[model samples]
Target: MRESTTLLRSPSNLASSQRLLFNSKLILPSPVPFKPKHMPCKVFCSQTSESSSTQTLKLISTLRAIPDWADGIKERGMKKKKSLYNHEKWLQHRSSLRHVRHLLSSLSSRVILSLIPPVIFFTSVAAVVAAYNSAISMNWLPEFFPLLRASSLPYQLTAPALALLLVFRTEASFARFEEGRKAWMKVVSGAEEFARQVMANVDGSSNVALKKALLQYIMAFPVALKCHVIYGSDIRNDLKDLLKQDDLSIILSSKHHPRCMIEFISQSIRLLLLEESKRTALESKISCFHEGIGICEQLMGIPIPLSYTRLTSRFLVLWHLTLPIILWDDCNWIVVPATFISAASLFCIEEVGVLIEEPFPMLALDELCNLVHDSIQEAIAMEHLIHDQLLTKRKNHSNEHLTNGRPTS
Candidate 1:
C-alpha cells in the first residue's frame, strides 16, 4: 500500500476540510500525519482539488455572510431592522393624537390567551351548574334534590380563605420576581462599569490582547450567569467565538460557567493591576457579579413552598367548583360569562407571577446580554484605537530622535 501524505496548510483548512471530509472516511496508515498526535491516520478528500476549492469558496462566502467582530464575536442583537420610535419621533412622524393611538395599541393578545385555560375551566363549572338549576326550575329535575338543597355555608366560608391564599401566592411570587430583576440589573450595571474601568484604567497600549480578553470575559459573565440560573450548560455556542479555545474549554468543563468566567476575568485584572490593594474598587465591582449570581441561584432554588402552592391550587379548585352553586341560585343561568371574567383575572395574575418568578427568560435577558456585549465591544474598540494612535505617535517621535542623532528610549 502506497501511503500519500498531504497537509492542507492554511488558516481556512479546518472549516473547509470539515465540510469536505464529513461524509467520506479514508484509512491510510501514517506514522505521523500532522502536528497533533490525535490526527486520524486516514485522510479523506473530495473527488478532486477543484471540488475542494469550489466547496472552500462556497464555505468562505457563507462565512462571510455572517457579521463577526474583530474579537471573534457576532453582535447578537435585535433582529428587527425597523428603527424604534420614541414619543418625540412619533410626534415628528404624525400628530400627537396619532402617536397616542399608536401607544395605546400596544396590547398583546397572547397575554389574554395565556389566562384563558383557567377561566374556561371555571366557566364550564358555572355553566353546568346554571344549566342544572334551570332544569330544576322548569321541572326537568326535582327541586327537593339533596345537592340543590345543600347549604352554601361551606363555600361562603372558604371563598375568603381562597382569596387570601391567592393574594399571598401572587405577592410572594412577585417579590421573588422583583428581586430577580434587581439582581440581574446589578449584573448588567456591574458588567458595564467593570468594562469601562478595565478599558479606561488598564493600560492596553503595551498589551491589547490582555485588555480585549478582560472585556470579552466581562461580556461572557452575564450570559454564563443566565445559563446557570436556567440550568443550561450549552454556552459553547454563545461564547465559543468570543474566547480562545482553551478558555472556552475551561468554561465548558466547569460546573459554574459564570464563576469560571469571573475567575478568568479576575486573574486578567490582577495581572493588569500593579498594586493589588489599589484595585479594591474594581474588585468590589467584580464581587457584585458573585452577589448577583448568588441571588439568582437563591431565587431559582428556593421557590414558594411546595405545600403552600399545592394548598393554594386545591383551594382555588374547590372554591371555583362551589362558586357556581351560590351564583346559580342568585344569577339563574347567567353565571358562565361572569365566572369566566372572574377566573380569567385571577388565573392571569397567578400565571404572571409564576412566569416572572425565575425571571431569567422573561426579563429580556438576551437583550440585556446583547446590550452589555455591545458596550464592552465599544469600550475595547476605543481602547484599541487609542492604543494604535499612541503607538503611531511614539514611532514618529522615535524616528525624529534618530534623524536628529539623539538617543531614543
Candidate 2:
C-alpha cells in the first residue's frame, strides 16, 4: 500500500512539473530545457531517475531544433517595423504641399476675357457719336442740313488719339509681362546650370552628403521666392526633402526664407572655397546662384509702381464715364457693343499686367511650383545615380584586386 501511494504521488508531481514547463515554454526566447517531468515513464525508482534524465536530454534536443532560438529575430522584426514607419513618415513629409490644381484654377484668363468686351464697345460708340456731334456743331455737314451740321474733324482726331493711347498702353503692359516671363526663365535656367556645375566638376567625386547640402540651397531659392511674393513670410517645413533639420531650424530662426537660403548658400560657398583648392570655379558657381536669386528678387520686390497703377486706373475710369455721354447722341444701337469692346480691351491689359508683375506668387493661372520642384528632384536623382555608380565601381575594383592576387591600396 505504501509503495502504491508513493508511486501515485510521484506520477502526479511529474505531471504538474511538465505542465509548468510547457506553459513557461510559450514565454521563453530560446531553446527550451529538457526534463524528465515532460515525458511519461513506467520505470522503477532507479530506472525512473534514469528515464527522467533521458527525458531532459530529449527536451534539450527538441528545443535546439526550434529556429530563431539563438538568432535575434525579435530585434530584427522591431528594426524592420521602425524602418517602415520612417519610410511612411518621409513619404508624408514630401507630399504635404498644395497641388497644381489650385494654380490652374486661379488663372487670370477668365477675368481678362470678362473685362474686354465692355471696354471695346463703349470706346467705339463714343468715337462715332462724338464725331457726329462735332460735325453738326461745327456746321461742316452738307448745306441741306447746315443748321444741324458741324465740323467732324475734331471728333475724328480726338477719337483716333484716344484709341491710339489705349492701344499703346495695352502694348506696354504686355511688354512688361513678356519681360517678366523672360526673367523667370532666366532664373530657372541659371539654377539648373549652377546645380549641374556643382554636381559635376566641383569636387570631381560622388559625395552624396555634399551634393544634398548644395541642392538644398538650389531647391530652397525658388520656394523662398514664392513665399516671399505670396505670403511676405517664409513658413517652416515648406520643402521637407530638400531641407535638413539644421537648415530648417536656422531658417526658422529668422523671419525671411529667401534671405535664409541666401545665407546658407553663401556659407556653403565659403566652405566649398576652403575645401576646394580651385577658387575660381567655385566663385563662378556661387556667382551664378546669386545672380538667379537676384533676378527673382528683382521681379518680386519692384512691381509696376502704385503711381503707375493709380494713373492707369484713373484714366480708365474717366474714359468710361465720358464714353457713354459721347455715344448717347449717335449710333445709339451700336453703343453697347462699342462700350463692351473698349472696356474689355482696357480690362484685359490691366489684368494681364497684374498677373505677370509678380511671377513667383503662383496665381491660379501662373506657372506651377511642380515644374521647379521636379527640376530640382531630377537633378538630385541624377546626382544620386552617379554616386551609386562610383561606389559600385570602387567595390568592383577592390574585388578585382583580390582576385588578381594584388593588395588593394
Candidate 3:
C-alpha cells in the first residue's frame, strides 16, 4: 500500500526526484519524453528495398505475444515496498533543531513510526518493574520476590563491547551501501561511453535503421539492469518504446535480463558495417556493462554475513530489555522514560543499518537509468542535424566543380 503513495502521485516531487533521490519506489518511472518504437522502423522502410519487409513482418507477428495494457497496470501494483528515503534525507533535520515544527515532523517520519512498537514494549516492561518496587517499599507485600535491580559494575564493563558491536554493524552496512552506489555509477557512465562510441564511429549513412536500433539496445541496458537488481520489475512497459515486440518478449522471458540486452547489442554490432578494429573497440565498451552487472549481482546475491546480523539484533534487544534494571538504583521511577529513550535511540541506529544492507533501493537506480535513455536519444537527434549540414555543403562543392571544371579553394 505504501507503493500507492509513491512520487508519481505528486507533481511537486518531480523536481526533487529528477536526480536528488533518483531512487524510485515505483517499478515504472515518472513519464519522460520519448519517440514511438515504430518511428525508426518507418524511417528505415522509406530508404531500404522490398527485402527489408521480412524483418517488419516478423515484428508484426510478435505483436500478439504482448500482454494487454490492463494486465501491465495490475503487475506494477505488486512490487514489494521500496526504500522510502536514502541516507541523505535521513539526517536532513540535524542542522535546524530550533523549530518545534521540525521536531514534530521528525517524530512523524516513517523511521520513527517503525520504531514505535519495539520502544513501547520495552517501556511497558520498565513500568511494571517500577510498580513492583513501589509495592515492596510500601509494605503491601512480604520480601518474597527479589528486587529487579542490577549493579553499575557489570554495565560499566560491557559498555565498550556494546559500543563496538553497534559501530561495526553500522560501518559494514554503510560500506555495502557505498559499493552499490559506485557500481551503479559505473553502469551509468559505461552506458554513456558505449553510446558515444557507437554514434561517432559507426557510419549511419549506409544503414541508418540498424544504427537507430543499436542505440535503442544501448539505452535499454541500464533499464534492464535496473529491473534485474530490483525484484518484481517487468521490462515490457519500461522498454516499450526502445525495443520491438519480439526483442521485448525475449528479454521479458529470460532469467537474466541485462545479459539478454547485451546479446541484442552484440548482434546489432555484428550486422553494422564497420572496420574490425572499430567493432572491437565498441565491443570493449559493451564488456564494461557486464562488469557492472556482476558487481550488482554480487551485492544482491551475497549479503553481509547472517551470523553477524543475527548477533547484532540479539545484542540490541537484550541490551534494551535489561536497561531499566541497571538504571533503577540511580533514578528509581525515572527508569521508565530512560528505558524509552535508550530503546528508541539505539534501535533506530540498528534499524537504519539493517535497511541499507541491500543497496539498490537506497541508491537512485531508476533515475540513473532514465539519464542514460535521455542522453542517447538526444545524441541521435543531434547526429541527424550534423549529417544534413554536411550533405548540403558537399552538394555545393560538387556543383562548383561541374560548372567551372575546377576545384573550389
- Checking candidate 1 for backbone clashes, the offending pairs are none
lDDT of 3 by residue, 153-223 (tens): 88889879888988898999999999988988888888888898998999978868888889889899999
Residues 1-409 of candidate 2: C-alpha lDDT, one tens digit per residue: 9987787579787799788999999778975677655554434666878989999999987755433232333223222211222577677656745355434654333443344344544566566565665676677786565322234454556667565655655565566656555665666676676677676655635454665687678766766655555543335656565688877787777776666777787667666633454445655655554665566567667766677667667776766656655555564446556666667766666655654454443332113344566786787688779889999999999998888996558
lDDT of 1 by residue, 123-224 (tens): 988888787777777788766864443466787777787778778888888888789889988999989998887766666566478878888888889988
Residue 236 in model 2: lDDT: 61
**Best model per TM-score:** 3
Better of 2 and 3 by lDDT: 3
Cα-based RMSD of the predictions, in order? 25.5, 33.1, 31.6
* Stretch of 10 with least lDDT, candidate 3: 65-74
Error of 1 at 35 (Å): 73
Candidate models: Cα lDDT each: 0.72, 0.60, 0.81
Give residue 277's lDDT in candidate 1 (0 to 100): 57
Candidate 1 lDDT for residue 228: 77
Model 3 alpha-carbon drift over 4 Å, by segment: 1-102, 390-409
